[model samples]
Target: MENLDIAKFGGTSVGNFDAMTSSYKVVVGNKNSRIVVISACSGVTNLLVELASGKCSDSKINEIIEKLRDIHEQIIIHLENQHELRNYIEGHLKEIKEQTLLANKGTNDQLTDSIVSHGELMSSYLFVALFKHYGTDAQWFDVRSVMRTDSKFSCAKPICEEIKVLAHDKLLPLINDKTIIITQGFIGSNTLGETTTLGRGGSDYTAALLGEALGVATISIWTDVAGVFTTDPRVVKTAKPIPELTYIEAAEMANFGAKVLHPSTMIPAVRQEIPIFVGSSKEPEKGGTWVRPVTKSEPNFRALALRKNQTLIVLSSPVMVGATGFLANVFSVFAKYNHSIDLVSTSEISIAVTIDAGTTTSGKAEISENMLNELRQFCHVKVETGLPLIAIIGNRMSENSGVITKAFDAINKFSVRMICYGASRHNLCFLLKDGDTTEALNELHKQLLED
Candidate 1:
């Protein structure tokens, strides 16, 4: 007998009542013993964040509340058996309103988790009701009882061992009953029993985590896009979808800039060597991208992704002539701030590192001024902004000679400042002016994939 599969849907896929109904049809059509994970409704998280931060006026909060009520109400009306489901949705909305008022008195961070969690909570509740209305045997399960993490409000780390044990003990019985379990994702409880979130767009990670624990055959992420593309279609005119990718290739693409999949979402799936499929909610027959272990075929091009608003910081220390521990001390400051270093190149006199610029509303680098001031302790530090990093990833690149040389030669006309190839040879990244990111991606795509 085939093992059960796990299907996870993102925000846009379940943005409203109609989309939710469409997603339910897709899941039912699969007909596998499965667990479904859902994210918050489209704009609910942002609205809740605004309300929690006191940025939203009373009118705005009320407006959001009414709008959310209408969305659920519409779903209730469309449901075949509307009486019980309508009552259930109405009751859940009342509970959410009361909880919102109670949470407003807490700290912003705690309130943020509380309010943002409502998105998943409300969506999952309605989903279970809709499933039952459609004559599917379904039940709602609160993920917090199974997924345990620390008290970190926004970015809680999953305690895998504890989660595995609890999930089998608690959720397996529900699965054995042949029930399709609907659960809220991106929200979990700490050892202290306080609600915590796994950061933005973390529902994907939740699905993968559950799949890993259950040792499921496959995890499907149903989203708005067809699949992972060579470049963001909005940015590149002729962007193409990558049919397949290795785990390392997918991780690099996600880390660099692919918005379809979260970087952390792959950890659990990879740990268990479970295959992941990224498909479309709108067009399920299109056959979206698949990610798994490396294959034997030599793929010409895996994918291209870009990270913009990068600040290149160059540190030149003439004071110490080859002093030991100087680099260590310099790096410790970044570690203290929990800042991530993306690209690095060092010489005897100078060290250059590229970091995300923390862009502003105008899309200009906001970190250039602040980072320049911090680098004053060193003999000389220069900050350059308006740069972007382009990542080209493929497992076959490890054995393929001249891949980097060919790629660099293709983009040689661009004002590239830095190039860093990973030691594993799975990724080749280059830095160029933000203006050239699109053109470079287009040229590389044509040369590698399209041509």
Candidate 2:
């Protein structure tokens, strides 16, 4: 099949009726826009997550369900097909309430996926109705039908070969120049037909995966931000929107801590070398960022990324003086616990690494004592919390003789916990106390990103 354009809108972009209408304008404006991916209306997923936690009393669950109903009702009541949409949403809300009540108490990953996925499901339904009301030819599409995955439940990985075939069979025939297919993001089905989610902020991943599966010409992501910025705008109010970046730069930015796109979002787009456009739905006229295989601009220092809530793990052992497999053994323990290490630096006797200190989808501390016990069996372990990882992302950073000096000079006053350089040309990563993030970003942005 020929390549088509795909568009995915984030939560805030479709937060309510007005937001959806703004995104709808972006959709109809682009004739090539064949598939429109929607996330749950802003704040809905959190409520669903709370409901699915099974910590709530019957009344609390009822209350959450009612809030969800009200959130959608406000938007539905504005729809021309209010009566039909209300009944449709009410049925799904009822199912959610039933599932939440019956789930084995405590956080069940499988049940969580099943329940939380309704956010996207209901939003897509409402979006379809809204589009129809605006006189656009749109149909609701179940992404799970084509987005087949393994049964990992809360954080499922897609089976790419299966997805390609499924997309051709299920999605190709239905999408055309005039027809707009509205679909859910972040949720998919496993081979056993159980609902699975691609983790939080997976909507971008969903759009990229579909674009890769269907050979899309370009993938447009409409979010609250104008585009990828020099640094987080909140951290540095002067942070400017980046007009263009190479795929590598963008991927590094996402992986390091840019919230605009999911880290995994770059994988599919990279695989197919598909270009992605990110812009704000509210101010579409202001333009956005374009990520391509290669861009005309290539600056040594492109952007700074700050990933918060990082825990620094330091493993010390006398056996590591000249050990060949010590690194492998340490990583093996992380793999056993299904945890990923972000940045690492080593000395003859110790290895220091940074990892996310956030809770797992299962609602447990990611760095559990059990995993620490295993590490302790081999080496002394010291863990530090409240450290955030900062990444200086750029192009040919290693080749830029003065980049490091200039970067460090910018934030020289701050205490640096760990630094990981020479690993990738794209970034220089380090950790700092959480309190220093905003100031560090400000200094770094002024030095590296600004003229």
Candidate 3:
């Protein structure tokens, strides 16, 4: 209940006319000052990436382009007095088509960003049209002008000081003037005026950043789900919604594959203690999950998170025993490739680490041949694919005897891989076969979250 509230809709939430209609009601139907941030239509970003690959045949790219055109045209046909919005779409799509064709000739990160950023651009303006159709005064703006970022391209970091200035100077005035500002999320610009992205699932980060800059206490993320669940409801039918969580729990769950919020989404919001709500766009009346700092004590256990397609690498060497700078040398190789480890365990003779099997550019599985070859210079490295990680996320895990006992006992039927604890009191991580992931998650959810 702040003066100005920020609402961000994900791909699924704004994927179609029905979805956008729900969002339009949420934004325009409200009396408060609302800034709406939107993602691409559900499937647009993926197809756009294909078109940008430069490897796709002309016919294939043309097919994707036609699909994009059709999706927008379908929605526009339903609107009244949309000449301006339709004209904007026609001109913008033509430009984007040209950019997509030229994208393959550029650097990897830059090229990928150029194509993927179009998703948010298309959705934001389309939502503006939806709001207008409902007889609301709505205007859409370019976030690139306000969300100033560094030149990291796909994974660019926001220069907060610069963004603070731009957002406050340019956006605040328009917002206060009673203009419901709709802007694209997941994209920004570097100081050099190049289009950049905040990585996938960044719209959450976008809202958090803007909410923090506007000095608001909360940002609402409208998604397909009712709220953050104790477990993925699809996986465990008995799973129920969790109403509130500390900022730490939400971030930990996201990091461990609670897909409701992006893992880094908490960074901006946490800096100023801004509460974030994860709610349903389809049914706004149903309460959602709130992530913020709270005064009252919470349960010792919060939720169970499972991440599939994980790869574990174990490096063994006697040299690691009583060795100085040994771990540093091992990490240096990964740093050279810009690869990050997800979970790590080490002993006197060996070190084990887990990383996502998905490629950095797309969420598809990829084997990192180059990284493995480099590690051969030091120790005998063993790699295992098809591993899934299960993390029990909560607070003060070491003292929570009941939940810990129940978790292990519940998953006792399934085989467990590397178990890591104490790295953070907030999490207990273990690796298992990808096949056993679902069953293990269900049983653990039954005890830790459901009970």
Clashes of each: 0, 0, 0
Number of the candidate with higher TM-score, 1 or 2:
2
Each prediction's whole-model lDDT (CA) = 0.77, 0.88, 0.81
CA error at residue 115 for candidate 3, angstroms = 0.5
Per-residue lDDT tens digits for candidate 1, residues 1-451, read 1667888999888887778887998898886737999988777676666656544555766787787777767666766767776666567556656556665554345556776787788888878877887788888999999989887667678999989999999987788435789998888989888988887778888998889888899999999888888788888878887788788888888878787887787899999999999989878888899998875554646778888878888889885576888788777767665556778887788888888643111122334344455666665877787688888876556576877677777777888788887665667788886675777888877776676
**Candidate 3 off by > 4 Å:** 81-84, 103-107, 295-297, 357-361, 364-370
- The pairs that clash in candidate 2 are none
Better of 1 and 2 by lDDT: 2
Worst 10 residues of 2 by lDDT: 357-366
Give the per-residue lDDT of model 2 (tens digit) for 1-451: 2557899999999989999999999999988898999999999989988887778888888888889998999898888868888898898899998888867355578988999898999999999988888998898999999999898777788999999999999998998878899999999999888899988888999999999999989999999989999989987999999999898999999888898888888899999999999999999998999999999989889998988788889999999997789999999999988887878889999999877744334433457799999999999999998778889988887785887888788878998888889979889887886575788888888888878
Best candidate according to lDDT: 2
| Error in Å for residue 119 of model 2 | 0.3
- RMSD of each predicted structure: 3.9, 1.8, 2.3
Which stretches of model 1 miss by more than 4 angstroms? 80-107, 309-314, 355-387, 396-401, 434-437
**Native-to-model Cα distance after best TM-score fit, residue 337 in candidate 3, in Å:** 2.6
Q: Report lDDT (Cα) of residue 219, candidate 1.
A: 90
Candidate achieving the largest TM-score: 2
lDDT of 3: 0.81
| 339: Cα error in model 2, Å | 1.7
